[model samples]
Target: MKKTVFITGASSGFGKETVRLFHEKGWNVAATMRSPEKEGELAALDGVLVTRLDVTDEGSIAAAVKAAVGAFGGIDVLVNNAGYGALGALEAASDAEIRRQMEVNLFGLIAVTKAMLPHMRERRAGVIINVSSVGGRVTFPFTSLYHATKFAVEGLTESLQYELNPLGIRTKIIEPGGYRTEFAGRSMSAIGAGGIDAYRQPWDKMVEVLAGWPMSGNIREVADAIFEAATDGTEKLRYPVGQDAEQLLAGRVQMDDVAFKKMMVGQIGI
Candidate 1:
């Protein structure tokens, strides 16, 4: 029997790549996105079911999961990859943006996981791969709101590991560093406050650094890591992809809070 994997954010980036890779490897793929109608390629592939799923909406999540189960028997792996990056200064972010960040990245992820738990628990088998970022464990000059939501994901996933493991459900966090994806392009939103001139210099500097950095890791690396996490059958909770993620995560462990902040400030030229 072919294993079925239900992936969120499957319209593009890591999620889309994962869907292709999994389908190529003979897995039944529930490739879901907010606008499944707009997806042409994946929907044409064999054993791939492209459906609509908006993580922030419970009805959409439930309906998409139902469609996947109906099409592929049951979901063996669930990938929570439907999130956008809310960048820029925290002060510049409105209440709505902040809440929206948490809604899609944190709360939405939790809700999807919860919705899938009963099915996985009944079968006593499943893997949940969350596409968190290196930002989850580290911080930079701007992107405070985005970092907050990702940090919450890291903490939540860590804790859930303990509870889900005994029930045979695996939780894995994919922390990608600098990836040249829609995440840094169309999916990224930079929040700006009208009168916050004090933050402008730092934000510009940070943007310049990120834009010029040579750390463009392939999205396929992240897709490969997710595939491994789903099939590896290990207790490993976190998989850091890219050299940037590996180095920064190591630096976080080796350096103290002040030292880390100083390094970050200097890097961003703050």
Candidate 2:
């Protein structure tokens, strides 16, 4: 029997790519997105169910999980990839945006994972892959709120392993570096005039620095890493994708907070 993998934010980016990769490998895929009606490619594939799922909405999460389990027997892997970055000066972010950042990136992920745990526990086998960012382990300018959520994900996933492992459920976190996905484009949000203007100079500088950096258009590497995390059958808790992520994490391990700050200033020009 083919294993079933349920992914959030499958409308695009790593989630969409992962859906395709898993289907290519003959797995049943529950490609859940907020707007299933708008889905195109994955909706047309065999063994792929494009369903409505808004991670921040508990009802939708439950419904999506139910639909996936009903369609594919049971879920063997759950990939939490539905999240976005709310970028601006920390003080400039409105309460709503701050709450939203946490809601979707942190709480929403937990809700979905919680919804699936009972079934996985009963079966005594499953993999839960949370898509965090290199930001989760490190930090940068104007993304304090985004970093907060990701950092929370890192901590939550780490702690989850202690509980989930005893029940044969593997909890893994994927930290991706700069990838040319919607994350850097459409999915990214920049607070406008509502935000403090004093930070614009630094924000613009950061943007220019990023524009000079090499971008990885192929998100397949992240998808492959997610695949490995799910099927490798190891109890490993973290998988950092891309050289940028690996390098940053290495620097984090080797350098002190002061050194890391200096490195960030030089690299980000912030």
Name the regions of candidate 1 deviating beyond 4 angstroms. Answer: none
Candidate 1 lDDT by residue in tens digits, 154-224: 99999998898999998999999988788878788878443598977777788888888776757889999
Q: Which residue pairs in candidate 2 have backbone atoms (N, alpha carbon, C) closer than 3 angstroms, thus clashing?
A: none
TM-score of each: 0.97, 0.97
Instruction: Give the per-residue lDDT of model 2 (tens digit) for 1-270.
Output: 999999999999999999999999999999999988998889999999999999988999999999999999999999999999987787777899889888999999999999999999999999999999999999988788999999999999999999989999999999999999888676788863344577778888877876787878879999999999998988888899999999999999999999999999998876
After TM-score superposition, what is the CA distance of residue 111 in candidate 2 from its true location, in Å? 0.5
Candidate lDDT scores, in order, read: 0.90, 0.91
RMSD in Å for all candidates: 1.0, 1.2
